[model samples]
Target: MRIAQVCAVVSTLLFTVVAFADVKPNQLFSDHAVLQGGMSVPVWGTADPGEKVVVSFAKQRKVTTADADGKWRVKLGKLTVGGPFVMTITGKNTVTINDVLVGEDWIGSGQSNMAFTVSAKVAAFAGMQDEDKEIAAANYPQLRIFMATTKKTYEPQSEISGEWKIATPENAPAFSAVAYLFGRDLNQALREPVGMVVVAFGASTAESWVSRPVAAGDPQIKTMLDHFDDLYSFYKTHPNATTDQAPSAPQTINARPGKPGPLRDPVQDQHQPTVLYNGMVHPIIPFAMRGVIWYQGESIVGGKAGVAIYPHVMEALVKDWRQEWGEGNFPFYCVQLPPLKNSSNNPMVREGQAHLLSLPDTGMAVTLDVGDPTNVHPKNKEPVGDRLSRIALANVYGKKIEFSGPVLAGMQIEGANIVLHFSHAAGLIGKGGPLQWFQVAGADGRYVSAMAIIRGEAVVVHSDEVVSPVSVRYAWDNYPDGANLINGAGLPAAPFRTDSQDALSAIAKDFTGK
Candidate 1:
């Protein structure tokens, strides 16, 4: 009797150990889980290669085999999203994921500002306020959150470690400020369950977000490559054997009393193609997102490949992301970098962002009037998210909402002055007085703030010093403190240049022409 009892206990212990060691559902199971409404949605996973796999969801059965490399995929036939369903997968072992939800999914990506979390900004505490009850009460049973960890790799990756988490006020503070706000809008507008996969890395350049080989195709990309190579060489030669591994040594040893180090981290400027995509984004490719929103470009501007190559890099990013996502012409909405000090280098990048808008199914949110000259990470994320959502609502989702502020259409040289025409200016009224950000210049090519007046559908700009103006610029300052040219909806028009010039003026000219 004693021997039999001991045998039973040992058998039970062995079963439990095997069960625990078996694959717990790969939380990064699927890049996308479509809201089962009309057609079949694909649900896939990776396991020991050649293992016979079985997937069971809501009485529906699907089977597939692990590929030679241990990657396996299976598609669940079309079903509906009205389920508190459970998903089970079996191969070398069985894995069950509970409280699974099927719903609308959105991909939110970009750089610092877009990645800024509520916990890090001024509005961090505001989320708990009674006024922000909507955000506070955002505990949607079907809403799911997947956050992509920051990564940089030379090649694309197939898996990452993030899972679907239900959204609540408890989970809200850590969410991406911009992405969370955008998702809030979608959740409210659609009145349906929502899923969001947020992939944002702070201070990343546009090139980092795109594939390397593709971005390198542009001759302009060589400058960035050369700059990084030089920095790498410097570090390689000056190897700090003792403290080199520390992140602060490079800055500490190469610094002046009060100024930044002359030699920045050689790695800081290494804007290699797909490095970030491989590490942070590769694990989540082809995520079934309704659209994409971008807020990057600042890092690229300070390097050797600055502003001039901004547009080409943007083009590459759009193309590569779309290709990897396997969706052609996906709606790519971007934020027009906010205004800054006269010394800021991002104005050119902003122009590059504007040029990207001319691409199919693309949109730009102009924030020239909302930037803080001293703060690179602006705190006014509400408007940014709203404007982005407005673009998606109008263009991608086909909602009949007005999407943009006034855009400079053209300038007609009439008499001794020029009349600037703007598009999307349905009710073009200066918020306070006549457009105060207008500037004019003559053949000698000197620009001065010009007197601007609303004349019918156009704004006539003139300067006393110049009787014949050849060029016109509006809100062209790096950071115009008194810029008041906003439409009735409180959206600002992007800065624009009519006649190109040299130096900083030439940079503005590059974007105006593109």
Candidate 2:
């Protein structure tokens, strides 16, 4: 009887061990996935501790042992661009991932703009222009998208939830509109499979997507961390406090407030620094991708301080993401906020965004002409995506195409006028009427409306109000309605200012309440 009882217990223990040892890959490695081509692809998962896991895909095999904590990873060599292949993982259990393709993969992330979908099916996402037609025509099987589930956490998470879906008419409507259009353009141009991994949250601040370490190190944005600490502390002390009783979270400038909830859960607030990165971005690190395309800055916090720190925050984000991904200086492109009225979308924010050009391998899609004065979320996303793809095609794919508009190269004071030189100014012309929105300022630091004329790859500006023009500014307003300086390629010129003294004075005024 004793021997029989011991046998039964041993048998039960063996079954439990085998059941818990079933190998499982990350959600990103499921069926219909697209592996990045021309780079080392990282495949990782969890298995039985000390188990030897072998991953086989497209004539390449990689082997690695699970760590003491049951984590395992293997890097496959560079893959050529082609596949409808199957990947199999063997360990204590066998897992097969089907319909995998090797192609160019890119990350598309930001706030609502990046999260906007192609159809109006979902009420949360404002659908883009030509929704029905765009959705009906979406039948590209080679284009795949993995939309990461929106999540927020106080600490970095090791696992995320999402799935890869091919671009069929049924699925395309739900895909991010900008990402889909960008991928569609790339797929058409390169004649290869393209994948877009979209991780974004609506009405979230840039600081919320930054890593905790990076956010804490920056003095300009460190207050975000302090606020989080205070909120977390309050939650810990008053675990049962209602939303009304809890300390009110600081409102992000021009951001829509989130639904009220229990204060014990700090992750519920998307504005908290690093929460989105912790929950959404951290789990997908080291996934091989060509580059990232970002669209944000409309939800900047801290008022003038927020606008002031935006460029630095974005710079830090780009650098930090590159470092984390182990991809050296990958192309980082962004969209300059378009014109809007009575909102955070202003000249200062756009100027701050332009500072990203100072970084290497970076580009900005100027959207001065694509904005809706009444709505922050413009329905027109076709130009935005096309411009982003234009940058990638020209720089990454070696395509001969105009990727940007006229950029302010330098300014020369010729007589009583300022001549603003520009690159990419081939056949520069005023679209409708004479060049409008130009302002000239003199030593008194006062600006007055000025007339501008296109003069051989440069715009000559002068004002009878200011005889000696020391500085010139073009399209410098929240809603530059008539600003229509475009290059030969018909791309509108980006807004620019020749001097920073006025900007400094504005900042001073903001702080001093003068």
Candidate 3:
């Protein structure tokens, strides 16, 4: 009887030990996943502490020992882009991840537009343009996608929930519209597998993408973050004195009565600085990728002040992401905010997006031609993706193609006229009609509509109201109704200014004395 009892206890303990020792790969590692080629690919997972972990794929097998916390990883060397192989990770137990492919990948990050799906209902579930057609045609098995689940956490998380999904008619309807189209173009152009990891939250601010420590460490961002804490503390300590009104929006909060209102939990708040990064981006660090394609700015483009600080925030984000990846600088391309009705901030945000060009390997896709002033979220996404792919082709795929439209290079104060010289000015052309949105300002710092004519690669501007035009602006307005400037490549020129009147110009002068 004693021997029998001991045997039962030993069996129970053995089962528990085996269960704990079993290895489990992250949700991102699964069948139909694409491993970035031409660089070291990292494969990581959790296993029993001190257990020997081995990863075998294709012709290479890497080994490592799990740490005290049961984490292990192996870096795969450069590989050629063909694979339909299986990856077997073995510890005390084994996990077989099948149908893995080696290829190029891009990370898609941003707000609503990036989160918009090909077949998802429109703003009010009205249905996206060509929803049925696009969903039916999504048959690219070689192209894989993974969208991070929406989550917001005050503390950074080590793991996130999501899975690799193959692009098929059955599953493509819900994939990010911009990301799906972009990946399709890339895979077709490269004639190899392409994968996209879409990690974005609709209506979230850029500050949410930065880690809390990094955001709080910056003096400027800290000022913005401090307001939230102050408001929360004020409310929590004096609940009866909460304000009568909600103050229109989240940032417009007031502790007027000196009490808490509805207890808006900042801990789970999506707008809270670093929450999205903690819940979404941090969990997937070190994933191999060629670059990122972003379509955002609506949340942060609140007004002049927001636009002025946008470039700095963008610069910081790029640098932080690069450092986190541990890979050298990678291309970061963004889609300029298109024309918007009644939204004075769009143009400023567009200028801020253009300002990011100062950073290396950065590019912008101008979408003035495709914009619909009536709708903030434009329905035409094919062109958006094609334009982005052109940038990638020229910059990353060793292809020679015109990837950008004309950009203001210099301004010559020739007499009363301002001759604006442009880069990438191949076959620069304005529309048949009179130039639109060109304004000239004099010493009085006042602007009036100016006459503009395309002269070869330069556009000359002059106004009767201002005899000596010291500055000029083009396509600068909330709804640049008829602004038409493009290169022979058919890409629209980005909105720009040669004047120092805008908020961005003033900040530049004050900050750099330029």
The order of the candidates by TM-score, greatest first, is 2, 3, 1
Which pairs clash in the backbone of model 2? Answer: none
lDDT of 2 by residue, 199-222 (tens): 999878887888988888887557
TM-score of each: 0.81, 0.91, 0.88
Runs in model 1 deviating more than 4 A are 1-26, 30-42, 57-60, 76-81, 121-137, 216-218, 222-270, 301-305, 500-514
lDDT of 3 at 421: 84
Q: Which regions in candidate 2 have their CA more than 4 angstroms from the true location?
A: 1-20, 242-264, 501-514
Q: Candidate 1 or 3, higher TM-score? A: 3
- Candidate RMSDs in Å, in order, are 6.5, 5.4, 5.1
| By lDDT: ranked, best first | 2, 3, 1
After superposing candidate 3 on the true structure, give the runs of residues whose Cα lies further than 4 Å from its correct spot. Answer: 1-20, 121-128, 227-261, 501-514
lDDT of each: 0.65, 0.85, 0.78
lDDT comparing candidate 1 with the true structure = 0.65
Model 2, position 85, has a per-residue lDDT of 95
lDDT of 1 by residue, 204-230 (tens): 777667665665566565545444454
